[model samples]
Target: MSFIKNYIEQQTLNRRSLLLLSAYGLCGMTTAATLGSGVARAAAQNPKIAWSYRDRTNPYWNSIVSGGEAFVRSLGKSTSDLINLINEGSSEKSLSDIKSLLSRYGSEVALAADPNDMPNCRPVVEAVSRAGAYVSTIWNKTDDLHPWDFGDNYVSHMTWSDVGPSEQTARLLFDAMGGKGGVVHLGGIASNNPAIERLEGFKNALKAYPNIEFLAVQAADWDTQKANQVMSGFLTRYGDAIKGVHCASDTMAYGVIEALRAEGIEDMPIVSYDGNPQAVELVTKGKILATVFTNPHWAGGITAALAYYAATGFFKPSAEPKEHREFYGPTTLVTTKDAQVFKTKYIDTNPTYDWKDFWSLGKGQIKYRS
Candidate 1:
């Protein structure tokens, strides 16, 4: 909370000092010159805020950026003040763009990022750390990576525990199929953490229902078009034998639906993750049996807030508890049963959040499998 107050005060001081100097006809005087330099040096303490992630074409990423913009607005700053570094799903581009910012802003940069993939997280965090910048990450990091390991520069990491939620959705799909049918999965990028865990959850559910047969699982790269193509191929191969579909994300589910529609197979049961508004609506319509809502809006704003506050020295990451440093974001299972309520509360009207209350929505510290 002090961080929010301090940020507002800093902005106020910057404006008030400039106006007072201009009124005194001291724009070119030594006093005004010093004030200007002070503002420039605010970077050394205050930092420039930024969010780096895959492109906003995906509804999930767009919601993430919306949250980031909301946090900027809360600070009495324009949304334009928050820099966006879009990687277009390329880890190379993700790291390069981050390094470019570090070269320009150095320790004055506070970055909240999704490293594009797990392997890219290390290099990205290393670049920021070497430049003495502050960073908070989500969704992609190797188990070996830790904020505490890098000291204060790596502020925190937040991610949803997708396994449980994905399994819950899968069980819903299996039950819809009467626990005995061929189910196929259209997954995200094979290497993505969510993709891996989501598929793992599907597999876990498969174990519980011995009568349900897994026809096939394919990587769709989390792209709607690609998922559509994959689903089409599955139809050609499995046809009426495929009774249910499990998608890694809602975006992919959209593609699967179109593929099914093309073949007049609209009645097939389906489930997915990342509860975009459209996906929630689909749930209400019985189009998608279930999906998981991860609250990317709050995740986006709070991740950036963590980095910004740490960069400005309002909070010390090193002193915070482990749960605050590495934690799971909130996750909600949305099904036909409560999709209407979810749509009204979370989809129709996004909730206002206290960005400074960083860990209120965190489920718990991230747990890794041995």
Candidate 2:
């Protein structure tokens, strides 16, 4: 309790003064004098806050959920107050569940969701907007749709620029392989944005290394067990020809490593993304060549806070610039040398973030080529 209170106080700074001037205050409460009871009105309306995502079996999703729970606490609400809608990997079920929540909460609902699939985001946006509920999404929106198009009800979209970091990790693997060898790649869900970008990153790195051949690439759907099986098949086909492995995520990397271990191969150069805690340990012990951390804590917390703030009339999303509405979240690469420092700051002890910093956020907006 003391740590949380001290953390919130540290986050306040001058933001508290800013809240007094407007009907908003992410740092603290807005006075009745500011914007004439707007905050009180927002509270009275009591918008039901909910977070929707795939199942909680994955460690990454569990971390994301922790961030969501933290945001609920920041709002002076119990974790129970933040409704959870787990889709369990079914796009149809995800849509059905989201619609049900919107119907139940009516216009007084604020939601943060990952669309499960790229195309699934569209119907969600349409439904949430029509129901007059505010929503913020992360990771899986289509390139054609813009949050600004749906006005204030669609608060923002957050995604990580996985290509840069993934490519960087790939290069590390290639260099360790003496810049010449065939490598198999284990990828995530086929149509998912991060999965696609990470695979593209591996291919892009391959372009720079003429001697290196991409032996094969298969979708693990970001599942560990599936990755293990996929990697075992690759080993049977490629054998000693495969010198390294690149995975779209750490979870898949774990499976890939296990498959290699079964064959008594422990030193194969491997690289992956989404610097999960276990992955950092793997990197630390030289099991993985590199990984990229997107800070799910920041991603999940800010995604929920964005919708909640918009619903509370803290800020009008329609008034904010395009970058604020749609932007890429921050990411960092983790290699063996610096893995310990990252573990201390991010993995061991969490960084205290001012989650209300939504507008001037992200590395860039989601872009796609025609």
Candidate 3:
């Protein structure tokens, strides 16, 4: 049957089912309770696929959505077949949207999400699990949560270890500053894992360079305009004392550059994360000292593939090892010396990926600090 026709029929059936359940006093009960107690839900056949994330205003998220569309097309479906649940950086909205999907599709959804923040992962997972749907998450999750604890419903979680890569970029920025001067950092949301790790990485690099003074750091919340305003304020406060800049993402770096340009200050050394195409181009032009590429395209495609396959019973999540359940995504440092090469290889053309070969690109199992 055509997916579109099937989707419409399914929507009708869901509405009817909900009305019947409501009339029978089952509306107040959880999906699990409404069905039965202690009876596990079976894997869904041709489950509806969805990707939940921040938004597409940023290049990083745009790439992520493009990857998801690629994966849906690989399934012989149009890119429009993929559902998007944009939270716009709201954790509450992220969870609510997932719940709404669950109420509609029930045990027939395969979701891949970032949960907007770490703490939100739990509620999102709980909602999916209760509805007997499958989920795979990236970037955000609490250290205490484990996939095994929730069985197959929580398919997997993947995150990039930014500490090492962020440190590499920080060292490059420090070197460009001649290893001694004041540097300020513009970062993402303070609660974000990448932001925390990137800041820690910058601090770690600072240990060896006592002459390089840490002037100040602030969370620009990963918005370009906010970053521009923050950078202007920093210029007013620090002026020529600021010799270098460390930005947590390429989006923020663009704002930093514009802020400098407005003041006729263009040569300040800077390093940022997320080797976005524009950022890579900037590196080649020596505008950015360095940045790290995390391959969001592959991450987005493979994450959805994992949840989809698990929902289809192609692989049993419970049988998989811990490393397969939770792991680190890949990262490569892009510097001025190799930026063009990196762009030619990764940016100019998106690498064709085997969505089913899930772990081939994974770095390793994610390790948490004590």
For residues 1-370, write the lDDT of model 2, one tens digit per residue: 1222232233234234422322121123222211211122342156788888875556688788889888888878998777767776778867877777765565677899999999999999888887777899999988988999988889999988888788899999999999998998898899999999998888899999999988899999987778879999999999999999999998788778878888999899999888888889888989888899989987888999999888888888999888888888889999999999999999996677787877444786666668
Q: Write the number of the candidate with greater lDDT, choosing between 2 and 3.
A: 3
Model 3, residue pairs in steric clash: none
Local accuracy of candidate 1 as per-residue lDDT tens digits, 1-370: 1222233235335545533432232122221111111122233555889888876657898899899999999989998788877776789978977777776666778999999899999999888887788899999999999999988889999988888888899999999999998999999887789999999999999999999999999999877778878999999998899999999999888888888887888788999999998789889999999999999999999999999988888888999999999999999999999999999999998899999999999988989889
Over 151-265, each residue of candidate 3 has an lDDT whose tens digit, in order, gives 8889999999999888898898999899999999999988888999999999999998889999999999877777878999999999999999999998888888888988999
Could you estimate the TM-score for every candidate?
A: 0.88, 0.87, 0.90
TM-score of 2: 0.87
Q: Please give the RMSD to the true structure for each candidate, in Å.
A: 10.7, 10.6, 8.8
What is the alpha-carbon lDDT for the whole of candidate 3? 0.85
Q: For model 2, where is the 10-residue window of minimal lDDT?
A: 29-38
Model 2 CA lDDT for position 179: 95
Report how far off residue 165 is in candidate 2 (Å): 1.2
